[model samples]
Target: MEANDLRSYISSHKNIFVLRNKQFRDSKLVIDGCNLYHTLYFTSGLDQAQGGEYGDFETVVRNFFKNLKECRIKPYVVLDGGDGGEDGDDGEFRNLKKKGEITIRKAHALSTGRLRNVLPILVKTVFVQILRKLEVPFVQCVAKAQWETAALANEWNCPVLSNKADFYIYDMKGGLLPLWSFQWNILSLLNQSGEKFVRAKEYFVERLRPRRRRLLPVFATIASNDDIHLDKGSLPNWAKPSKGSTATKDIDALFKWLSKFKKQKQAINGVLSHITDPAYSDKVHNVLTQGLEDYQLYLSSIAEFFTSGTALPDSSPCLPEWTLQQLAKGKLDTVVMDVLAKQRTVLSFPVENSLYSSSNRTSQPIRQTIYALLLGVTDGAYVEEYDREELEITSSRVEAVLPSKVVPNLQLETLKDVKYGALGSVLSYWPLGTQHATSCHLVGLGYKRIPNNLKLSYSMVAKAKQQFFRPRQRLALKHVSHYSFSTMFRPCQKCFASDFWVLYC
Candidate 1:
């Protein structure tokens, strides 16, 4: 039975939730097998395309297993055994088949392309093959997959991964949506067991404590089967009026009243008491009382089904102990460290002299501007007229001394009219620590460019001072009295030595 509108109810109260990615590490995840099949069909885009064969299914399932392996997760897959006598007689199965056919016809009308008829038996067969190939342990339940999965999760103390919203009603420790668009959340039980399951910085629910009494389970079973939608108002009569009134309202009012009590037993008792009262007519009272008894019997039968070994089959496949051991090891740390190493390599500045080639000289002004921006220096002349001239003279001298191929085509004139309107355009190319040095030559050139009467704004002056002094500040702290000439060509280090030279001369 579907727990309608339950997910929406839980979402409205979000303080009780935590993400799955933050907590699922090294945890056993129980997957609903049929749910996975349906999720794959839609999410893999197989549903949208024409002429898709069942062979494409293995690739999607393989990728899913690969992701689980990457995350260091141990998964237990459970598939449903057909019908499982949930339907009272043959008529129910016939009715269900008729409904399925109707649904198929409607789907065909709505679909634009040729839709493959994905039967349960066909999908299950493919799934068994893939599971065996991957060496993943799985089970096929004798009855409904939902209850079996829920019972197994409760027994194993793991979370259930399924698209079914009704898992919330089943009181699973967690419900995970493993779709592409799924967010991380552990829909935990409110009591102490839930507290132990959540990770640091994750949240837990205090309000949704599960009721343990037998009668409350009956209430849950009735609520599950009944088509009556629950809202704020559908509560019992005793919970309605403030301590005195005997008046009764509809199911909506009854639900609202019952919600006030922390325990479901109290609410169920209130409901029972209200319906059994002498104020009601004998015919109505007898019918209501009999319905409650029937509900109790139905609840008992369900309990019997769960306790019976036949209902929940032990269908878990045997796998090698070494394979199971491999699944348990956490690999996220290694993956994360590798990612960090790559990032460090990318962030490290190119220190080689060959990078100073004339072809790269044209990129200097933009690089200098980005460095200046990182240092919070905005008003400074990023490429001073003198610096340009000095570069040109140096390039000419080098060209006369060395072979033509050795001299780079330095384009100092290109930076003459460049303005620093926004550094975002070029910031991506700049290296880490590019902003630490103070280019006093650029700052002095900037000072010279400003008109005497028209003073630069405080923000502009501050940015310029910060850009110019930050590098010197860093160098002074390091006890480095002089900057090397080789490092001088780089913007961050260039500022340091140029500033020192300007100070000494």
Candidate 2:
């Protein structure tokens, strides 16, 4: 329903246009906040946080704002509220519903120990909070965030910042900002002389005729969306065409047929009255309406797919080849490497050693330790032994050794979970002039000292503290409060006290 494949068609036909950073200077930009959030989360590996203070969320938010400010762009971020009713009033709401359905299916899979990956939703609230604290202008749309963003973009005559390929369908005139400038590959297409080559964006915007006709491709994209085919079995007969006939093909045929009629409605009706039976005309109208409605429903479903916080199952034990290639190429940042290391550590053990080892397994004490360490339950299945039989074996002969607490409130289930994000947060709260020389030396980084003598400007340090330290403290406090509400542990007082000191200090 997302019309994801439409991007390929756009690329092949050279429809997307790119503007340089200079072009965006002082420009008003409307953003699809959900789209941007997920993009940042995946790229930065923030969505893996199950609970506690997640610095990656703050980092991603700060980086996003920094990018916008660097470009001198005024941003209006729109967030999806929820799924609105079936009248197709809100695009994001419908999308959320579809995603929710997918999440339910994925959740079932998760319960059965199936390897499924789910999108994270808890971070969006944090993102919105950060935006508010930064005083960035944003709106929580009553319906679909996309429609609100598009409407705002249209009204302000500004570009929309989103990665969704379907934004073209909104018929926005302000154009779209490429999600990230670096993500787009430079596509080469022929020039006017047919002898030279030009960038895809230039070729599409400058050379394409009848600019309004750009929507034609978008319409075609909708008709040929993957969701339609995915849901074809459930689709009404009117929604499906005969063999070898597609909605896109039929729509093209209709356009060709209509070209023979006069442009005006009265003329077309007069021609139809003479050439076709009234019943046939009515039937044709019905079919078109039904097809359009079905398409709308499919679009709604796409919205749900994204909104559903269903983590997809990873069937393979190893990292994605592209990820490995990136690491080999040294394209990954230190932070990314740290995240990858954490994942690698988790996957190093056999499936029987994992927390989600068996279907009939009672919650293990290690689960609580993992929850405390990672600040969230491990919500995924082990890749190597994903089958029901493999997962049904409850016995675990191996014992997990918990790591010592680095700080007052910090408790690590294993040293592997002590990645940069978790360790960095604890390090930030330690007393000034603390050093971990031996550990740093072992890692080939020489002696590591906290609160170094290098003096940073007051404003710089304040901004850094505000962006990094404060949000983490707040999130930790919130998590502590949740723990108290659930009464999950008898040592709540001790835990809260330690959390308070560590977070506040």
Candidate 3:
């Protein structure tokens, strides 16, 4: 679901979000890793264009956690695996909804000179890097992290720090602390509790919500989300033309209509009764039912994973157990999940590129090399890339090749297999963060690099025909603060803190 729309609308309603100015006490906080990075990137006052200001971003994140440590707030971070869809009749619709979101983001980047927000693709990888560096306990879910985030928050009797509107629907013990209201940076210098507490808006779902709390999820089910993709144009206007036509009025119309029903079943029926064409009622019903189920509180699979060390089985044909553990531990990126699940990968635009051109053309070979590594064990493997071909999003089968034309004699097995050391020998320009399984460029070969620091002139892909842009500065990741960029790689995956800034970062 596009939760921001609902979140924004509800936030405007009176008595919803309450100020937690001095009430912000030391406690366990369940942090949504994806939301944390997404919100922090935009609020950090860094460049949305110019490829990326990752160095500045690192500092922003570091200071954020440093403040948390000062306040003694223990955080457990959880992040989404991908925009993956569960396989079923409506799976295509859901996948399209997710991809449509990407397309819209791309369009936003294209329309604006990137003055608007388009999260740098490498944000998650770098986020994981920072998390481990701070010794923060965290988990990267196999797919969605919202359920587990709420679960952990409930279990720990603590608040959730996220901007997801779904959190508003979940009736957790400690409620939600929205990202916009989480003023972690602003501290009272003269006050005694200066660094001892956070200032933010908290949502006490059971307290602040309307009398009909049960209908919260019901309202969410009818509101425009990924499942329904409902648009105002299709529905009758709840506001007048003179009153100013906006999505707010349409939402008001929904709430007004819902006010008539005493129970959710009646409301659901009422929603379906208005379907002008009977043909779509069944589909709408199914979607609404599924969305309602999303709000149902239960023991989270991720929580179970944390306790039992098991992994979610959403991947097709399933991934190797060791790979799953690495993902659970945040050692490996979800790129492995996408590769295993969809057999396709998405390519993002560089900030300096034209809307028409794909800036990642220079690094396609690296991606292909990665594709080869992940899929090499299987026969006649191919990976379709959701990339750009002049003003349109296009898919292409990336051709795989080994770096330096040297093949690493490693068996396609677990990440712990020492044969991967041979795998490290074949690749140049990078060493692992500390150990010897993966390297920086190597993980980026997994395609994290192409969308990241691999900046070439947007219009010069053919004319210049350059391989890659050199690092803005030359040094190791630990000494990065001395220069323009900073990185703290994961040791278990053996990727991070490499000597060369170009390949490692």
Candidate 4:
């Protein structure tokens, strides 16, 4: 391809921002199984990414592993196997597909070999290094059932890692966002036999070298699947409301269980102390509580989505075979028939049915000004900008009115509604921390029906957004403090860090 064409390809993928140079890699680094790794390559830039096959694929893999060692962060890769990909190679279908599994072919099919390439080489290479040289205890899982990861992590007494939005759906535990930072979080409460909820940070530290007095209940008090979509009237299900049982029974059960353990208050106080700087602690507590409250509100919002029948699958991007199978199984719950019939267009896509991953709804388009007081905003300027349009601009535009030329005011209103709709639908299965923060962010944005209990407004929403946002200056500061310049672009590291930022950031 021509240089310009390659450049364009790389630029397009830039939005996904997965570029992580060697500098970021260290034995201390823990990656989020495949999602972040894939995004890094696919989102680095349109030109480079589109010509991905042409690139030195193995080198990319090498650099990814190499960077991990240089960073001093123990690289633990989680094998999600979310597709259920099994051995008969069934075109890399779900792992649930056994050796004898077979299926008829469709005109278009994704390759199974490439799927295998996704992990084995990387895993084997990493394992060889750790088991032979690094002498670190690394953990991985390849289970038929996705939920098995939680079970294995619990049994082996190791950390679990994933980035699925519906992690709350399966109640999978140990949540960590690898690219953002080095910290690990316990994502779920489970059937594991060990002490409930080990903090990932402490767990990893202990793994490096045994430590005394490990804290039990290292996780926060998370509200389980409340299925807010049903409550807010989004999706309908056969299960009865879990709230009554949860409130009277579950809460009491949790507290009673806690009483069985000693140092409950002391443990809580110790965690609080870790975040001690008064101002920082206040923010931490605020965020933690805000996250919880959002979960509650999300529970209430589900009613609207269900009542309106808006939570049905989009099915616009499903894999061809999966789409046909869903059709054969009569799984296409809703479709824009006119569009399908008249155009004979492909309607199926990877339906993001998981609440934790994404929501089907859009957002509201209200014009409200939000002042972003960012650490990196030139001179740490606290610019006050009005929402004159619909676009949500955060980068260098510092403070600008919404509904910019790129986005319409109506689009913003629609987006607002979408967020509310998503909260309603996913609240049932999402963790309290995620759900609560989402709700608070929405309420802070002036969503009309948000209850007074949420105590959210545009300012609060901005703060929540800040948790996810990192000013360029802040990231730059982190990079400088963390590593030397020569190590930044070292070989064998993943290539999509730059792309991931553009899309998600």
TM-score of each: 0.41, 0.43, 0.76, 0.24
Which candidate would rank higher by TM-score, 2 or 3? 3
Where model 1 places Cα greater than 4 Å from the true spot, the runs are 1-4, 7-23, 48-52, 86-102, 111-121, 171-223, 227-255, 272-505
Better of 3 and 4 by TM-score: 3
lDDT of 3 at 63: 93
TM-score, candidate number 3: 0.76
In model 2, which runs have C-alpha deviations exceeding 4 angstroms? 11-23, 47-53, 85-97, 104-117, 182-208, 211-505
- The number of clashing residue pairs in model 3 is 2
**For residues 218-331, what per-residue lDDT tens digits would candidate 3 score against the true structure?**
787667565564544454443332222356555666665566677778878867766776667887888778878877776666766656767755544546666667678766
For model 3, the local distance difference test gives: 0.60
Q: Kindly give the stretch of ten consecutive residues in candidate 3 with the minimal lDDT sum.
A: 496-505
Rank candidates by lDDT, best first. 3, 2, 1, 4
Each model's RMSD to truth, in Å? Answer: 28.1, 17.8, 7.3, 25.6
Order by TM-score, highest first:
3, 2, 1, 4
Q: What lDDT is obtained when candidate 2 is compared to the true structure?
A: 0.38
lDDT score, candidate 3, position 172:
93
lDDT (C-alpha) at residue 3 in model 4:
18
Q: Give a tens-digit lDDT track for model 1, residues 286-316.
A: 4334434433311211223223422322222
Model 2 alpha-carbon miss at residue 103, Å: 3.1
